[model samples]
Target: MEMQKMSNGSHHEYETLDKGIQPEEESFLPEKTDTGKKIQFNDFEGKTSFGMSAFNLSNAIMGSGILGLSYAMSNTGIVLFLILLTAIALLSSYSVHLLLRSAGVVGIRAYEQLGLRAFGQPGKILAGVIITLHNIGAMSSYLFIVKYELPLVIQAFLGQTSSSGDWFMNGNYLIVIVSVTTILPLALMKHLGYLGYTSGFSLTCMVFFLSSVIYKRFNIPCPLEAFGNFSNNATIPEDTCTAKFFTINQETAYTIPILAFAFVCHPEVLPIYTELYNPTKRRMQGIANVSILGMFVMYLLTAIFGYLTFYANTEAELLHTYSKVDPLDTLILCVRVAVLVAVTLTVPVVLFPIRRALLQLLFPEKAFSWIRHVAIAVCLLFCVNLLVILVPNIRDIFGIIGATTAPCLIFILPGLFYIRIVPIEQEPMSSRPKIQAACFTSMGFLFMTMSLTFIGMDWMSGEKRSGGGH
Candidate 1:
């Protein structure tokens, strides 16, 4: 619900096959195991039961970025699109269950602790790095989107050309403004307990963003035409949603690498689950169901609306989705600004961990204080600024971060942690966890390989098209 915070970082332990391995179902079945040491948070004064705290963690996790998910799914094709969305959702939910199980058995409150418990010191450090980098990538992308979209709307309203180099439009310049406006409020505030109501604001923005697209498409007098009917023979559109993009043919080789990037957020889930005080089996199940269901619906709605709004003309710069529609559409513009700001503000919240980890690793004896918080905030701002300047294209920025780092957070680290330390180490099924972890590692490795290949190829392709050739 809240956008900003001061002086905090969280480690999320997750892993993928650092190649293409899948989570094996065999590992999840219970086995005779050591009852873990009772673990409890020291700050338990305002502890919330698992069922009690739906406030905004899931809502935060299910944010404006997900609104664009359906469009991404559409690129995969109706069948593959649905399949990928469903598969990723199920896997993501299962990942939460695995994380919860890991915590319950190890008495580890933070995700890093689970990594350390399972994989030794190296494991903990590795997990921390993955989560940190993945989040950094995420935050930077958000900054780019906010800086890029919001000012363009303002300029459009003023009937002035947006200067790409202008102070208001430059990615880094906008980062400073948005970060200060958004993050400063959150950082200055304490008592995050009361922020549940903020999720309502975010939820409203999300709802309006979708409804605007739906309304506009329908008002055009043919809502179904927005999707352009499922054609059996017509040549597909040239833009992303064109049917040609979804093939099991040669292009399939190119897609698997991006899969690693798209399927992440595993690290963030455990912290939310751990905060669920003394959860029962049923309560935990409820949290998982609610979180997953909310995410699924948001992703599906946003993606479909994005595709319809953009249709065959969807550009790599998704801001066009808003710009192409009449600029005078006041409701749509409001929705755009709200969603953009929400996504932008999330950067500081996500980045809180890396700053903390860096501090802990570099200076362990110090107390958390105003000076420390300011220093970390400044450092993170610098990092974000550098990213915004270097990576001007928000989509490409996401690809870099999501492809290069997200897999580490999502699949490889979590999988490795589960396999390395099973609660039922005495049982034969404990071996299954190792296999499952190996699969996750394989997935990560596959992603790394593909990311390098595609990035290199994508870069080369851009060069070829730009230098006096078509």
Candidate 2:
């Protein structure tokens, strides 16, 4: 037997969780002859029907990027941001639909699993490499945000001295603390579901934080009550609120772009479809609705809060805005703590998938062996910690990763998967026009290239010229 090469790259492991599901009786499938024909739609055993589907899409949507959404959207305008966010989120939900449809045809549990089954090891390797680069970078940025944001939170609530002034001290202990906070939770959890309650709690804290900021605005001298939950729309007059939803809503150009990127890409959503009880178009839509709407609300609230609170400040950034609001009370302190801990808790949840993927490639037959799993898991946690400590700033890293990964994973890859895999007769969208497929694929290719370029620039700027090269 030929040995399967791993060449998994930096991705530790992206596991295929035992969904423990019962097959829906209603699903369509082809039955084969007694000889060697084929049985189609053979029901998958042990799928996690709606377990992962219920993953607070709001939580997935509201994650690390959310902490910065306000700032990212700062210049984009409040109405613009909200309107764009809403439109973008809907697009993501649709992307998920297309991607899932492709997966169903391919008969894969995990999305990356498709890359392996369809394209072969090299394809898997390439996809893994791209995903790993993007994921690790993205995860690292989250760590960075926690490091800086948490301390300010700590000082504000506890009355301890703190400042963004000391660059050295900030980076040093900040990473250590973040690594400890993020890594510990990850190491302790045995299953993804184990962290479900914590994720829920974390999400609640986020909503609470938004509420606090909104309430605080009322207490401010000039409360921007008018800005509450108001999303923008280009169709309406820029300044008028009554006639339309919000005049300054998102631009049509970026709507597709943003939607292409924003709502989906949680990594866990794919499995949800596989595990669905009935796996009906109706059930799938329900799962998607819960998943997408949940996320949309979270993003919208956070974006709006940030806009109302920091729209005028020089920074207009989320964390910076929080600092300005400077709510040092016990309640506020607790709120910051909740946000810190919630974000920190999410690290392990994200890492688990990468670990699973690693196992499939490196040890195909013995994929689930505990020894290999533990060994790799420990090593990855250690490495992430090392990187967290080594890197100086989280925001810079965060920006780089978001710019690189967000486009493809969010807008581009899903589209590409649908375009390449699903036949028109199977899942036709003839009304939308095929140009969109071309556009999304091209965009993904371009963004993936951009991510590589950004990393290449980082390498060049960080390294010195070798004597022989000249």
Clash totals for all candidate models: 28, 23
Tens-place lDDT per residue, model 2, 1-470, is 01111345212222222233212221222233345433323234324346454653344455555555554454456566666776666666676766666565544445576666546677567556556655566556557667667667655645666564654346557756656655654545555555556667777777787777667555543322333433443243343321122333322222223333455354656534444454544566677778677777766676666555545341423554444444465656666677777667666666666675666557654524566666766777677767877766554454455556667566566676666555565446663634576666676676556545644555678741110000
Q: What is the per-residue lDDT of model 1 for residues 1-470, given as tens digits with 9 covering 90 to 100?
A: 00111233222322332123222322221232245433233233334554334544554455435544444544454467566667766766656666665564443445666766877777667667767776776676666667667776776566676455566655556667767777655643332323444544665666677677677655543223334553556665555334333535433444344333444545545544545555443466576667667756766666665666555444333445455545456776777787775665455445555664555455544555777777777777777777777764555545566666666665666666666555443323446655666776786677677766766777877741100000
RMSD of each: 8.9, 9.8
TM-score of each: 0.74, 0.71
- Whole-model lDDT, model 1: 0.55
Which one wins on TM-score? 1
CA lDDT scores, all candidates in order: 0.55, 0.54
lDDT of 2: 0.54
